[model samples]
Target: MSKALTSFLGENLADLKDKGLYNIIDPVEGPNGPIIKIGGRELINLSSNNYLGLATDSRLKEVGKQAIDQYGVGAGAVRTINGTMDVHLKLEETIATFKGTEAAIAYQSGFNCNMAAISAVMDKHDAILSDELNHASIIDGCRLSKAKIIRFNHSDMEDLRKKAKEAKESGLYNKLMVITDGVFSMDGDIAKLPEIVEIAEEFDLITYVDDAHGSGVLGKGAGTVKHFGLSDKVDFQIGTLSKAIGVVGGYVAGKSDLIDWLKVRSRPFLFSTALTPADVVACTRAIELLMESTELHDRLWENGNYLKAGLKALGFDIGVSETPITPCIIGDEKLTQTFSQRLNEEGVYAKSIVFPTVPKGTGRVRNMPTAAHTKDMLDQAISIYEKVGKELGILA
Candidate 1:
């Protein structure tokens, strides 16, 4: 390694640590489930993104293993070459059906999907009006596309409309697009897609929604687009198989032509190796389960409500979260980190969210309640939260 590169990285790491922005990742001793073991102690897990608990579902594990036995562990080449396997095609078809779209295309992950799809469709001539709170992947994708990115206020309709009008009237760009997360993960607030659709119609702008967090948890597993009944209206519906679906891949569900174009032009699909056989099959099975029953979905909401109620009752500032993604706003970065550490020391495992992720002075401990968590587990976590909050003077 070059000495200059090493020194640069070392300096940055020190700065991050000094600023309380560095994260210490915990290694789970076993499967990430309702209760997780780390540092030899089992704790009620609230930090995982395994929304539906399919990450450790016996059915998915069985199917994945069977798939690995049938097909090798890897997809040999890029999809454009020989990597496009039967399993991949099947997964795409399943995603299309699940998303209620005419066609769908899968990628290795949600970040790659965004990087691939955005640049494939939009160019430097196009301007993208994005939500300010959009995921980091969106920001990178917009940069990669070289599109003129105009950020609108978080879920603010007036700001979006004003920017849309300006972009259209400026005539400096040949085309325009609007992108947003279907559910803002940090805040758990659902995007205002209905109004956004109306705005898009008014401006003839291409609309894209990354529904990574909403899949399997919204619209009976169809996602936020279907939750709002704008399946036909929205142009690009991006989803991750990893989050609520509890597998490993991302996809874009849209009209057949749009998917067809992406399959040919998307760089990640053409350059990167396709998802492995086992991951594809496992994701497909997860989607099938989601479509079959709402048991897990109901449980997830129930647990979210339970936890939210508990935190609110304890006088912790639980932000306005419309979904199961909960954030206990602590305001101070050090306090937030200390709170999360205290929770781990006790019997809970919610992670801290601080600067660069959220605005300064709004540090928080984010909690993700999955379907696997029992009521007793939630109750215990709440009691721990109460204890920690009172001790820290965060609660009265």
Candidate 2:
């Protein structure tokens, strides 16, 4: 490699390590359920996004195996080419039904969906009003669109309204779009979508919501838009089949025209290989399960509440999370990392999240309590937290 490239990598790597910003990944030895094995050690997992625990469900596994037997493993081509199979159509149809939209289009992944959808519709002549704390995919998508991105304060409705009005009234752009995450991943706060939709209507702006973390956990398993009764108002409803659906891929549910446009115009849909047959079938079954029953959804909230109550009672700074996601806030990056490491050492596996994933001085060990986590597991996790917190001087 060139000396210039080597020098740049060396300096950045050392800087991250010295500052405790570098992440160390541990491979899981088994299924990503409430309990997981890492390096042959069993630990209560509070770090996975398998909110419903369907990733290892027998029913899903059966269908996936059957699909592989029938359709083979791969889709073999891009959607616009020969890759759009009957199973792919069924998945999209299921997504549209679950999301309460006229139509839907699937992509290779949630991140790719944003990259495809935003740039396909908006361009340099457009302006996008985005939440300052939206996922990185949204940020990159807006950049790819070459649109003028105006960031409003995180979950601050007044700031969003002010920015929306200014952008709409300025007449500098031909189209105005407002985008935000239905649930902020780090803090677990729900977006002010009701107010955002109100503002969007007043300004004739296109509304886009990426409910990657909210689907299957809210709206009786439909999603955040339907939870707020604004499914008809939002122009784009983006979601992932991975997080709550317990599979892989992403999609956009909207009017038939938008879906049609994406099928042809979205670069990812046109250029990238379609989702694997097994993934598509498993995702479809997962959505069906969510729509059929709220057993998993209710259980997820129960476990979440149980865990939150336990942590809050122990005098830890659990942030303002409205969903099942729980974040134990630790102010210093090194201390936060140490807290997480200690937790793992003691049989809990909640990982530390620090800058630049979150703001500096606001590092946290984010916990995701899933339906599969029983009260016993949560109680044990709480006990471990107390031990770690006291040892780390984070609790009284």
Candidate 3:
């Protein structure tokens, strides 16, 4: 109702549209899976983060519904209050066990977990060396800490070492922390955690890893820290219930004292309503499944390799992805969006990602291969990519 506010939004939205930066969110007609129905059309889904396809698993669905029936749809209050249900404790315990940490604390979402955890531990007197290509939530959380944020080049160990030395030797801040994504979501590259840990140890830097994309896909489903045999060395391991867990929430798994401090001091846990009983229970079961077997994890990597090989054969630059995430790099933003749109028309559903999600002129149609995608589905998607690429002059 405020004219000035309306005018500001109108101008910005028009600017976004003109710059090809406005995102059009699509609605799925059914559950997200290997194949999803969107706007009444069935397409092989390559745009989702449902890495293990647990989002639509029958077992998870059943457990979620059971919780809804027994409890309710909502948590009803913040965690510091009546919202801390028995199921919440169980989910945190499950996270701690899965992450191989002494304790863990859950939050309303992965983004919230970053916001709460960072500010809870670091402040203006601290400095953080963050990955240049970390997720948006990590950037926001670091900003919230009011800490002096320094960005190291993406996956450049030498730069990280130099920065760590500078920050540590400066001795101007009360503490120095280094944070990075366990897996770089855009390029599907695994972080060089081994070297990062080495630098951290050398500089006495506190360590934090946002393992959202690596939770169920790395370290035999434990995570990136475990992937590098640094479970005990990592001070904070952040993860999501929404992605591979196929539920909703986020958490920080760390030392018992850190967990206790987060419970009492994290703003989101203290101010926001907790995760629902259904979400908590479903997440717990997901972790259990991950711990019990590596079937899904193996399948996910298989699918990823299959897709990547096919794309590479067809002359697509997939960047330097070391994981199941595939990006068909299209240097122009509008062309990238057009490539994705044409794929959807041809029965594949990969979305275009451009600046500021990625650097300018490096827009891409990113694909996330899940454990549940059949060979036929992947083959079909690859064929579609070829057809679209040739037609659009992207391939010879």
RMSD of each: 1.1, 0.7, 1.1
Using alpha carbons, what is the TM-score of model 2? 0.99
Evaluated with TM-score, which candidate comes out highest? Answer: 2
TM-score of 1: 0.98
Q: For residues 139-171, what per-residue lDDT tens digits would candidate 1 score against the true structure?
A: 999999999999999999999999999999999
lDDT accuracy of residue 18 in candidate 3? 84
Candidate 2 vs candidate 3: which has greater TM-score?
A: 2
Count residue pairs with overlapping backbones in model 1.
Answer: 0
Task: Candidate 2: list runs displaced more than 4 Å.
Answer: none
Angstrom error of the Cα, residue 57, model 2: value is 0.6
- Pairs of residues at least 3 apart in sequence or in different chains that clash in candidate 1: none
- Estimated TM-score for each candidate: 0.98, 0.99, 0.98
For model 3, state the Cα shift of residue 284 in Å.
0.5
lDDT of 2: 0.95
**Tens-digit lDDT track of model 3 for 1-396:** 699999999999999888878899999998999999998999999988898989989888899999999889998988887988898999889899999999999998999999999999999999999999999999999999999999999989999999989988888889999999999999989998888888999999999999999999899888888888899999999999988887788999999999999988999989998888988989999999999999999999999999999999999999999989999999998889899999999999999999889999999999999999999999999999999999999999
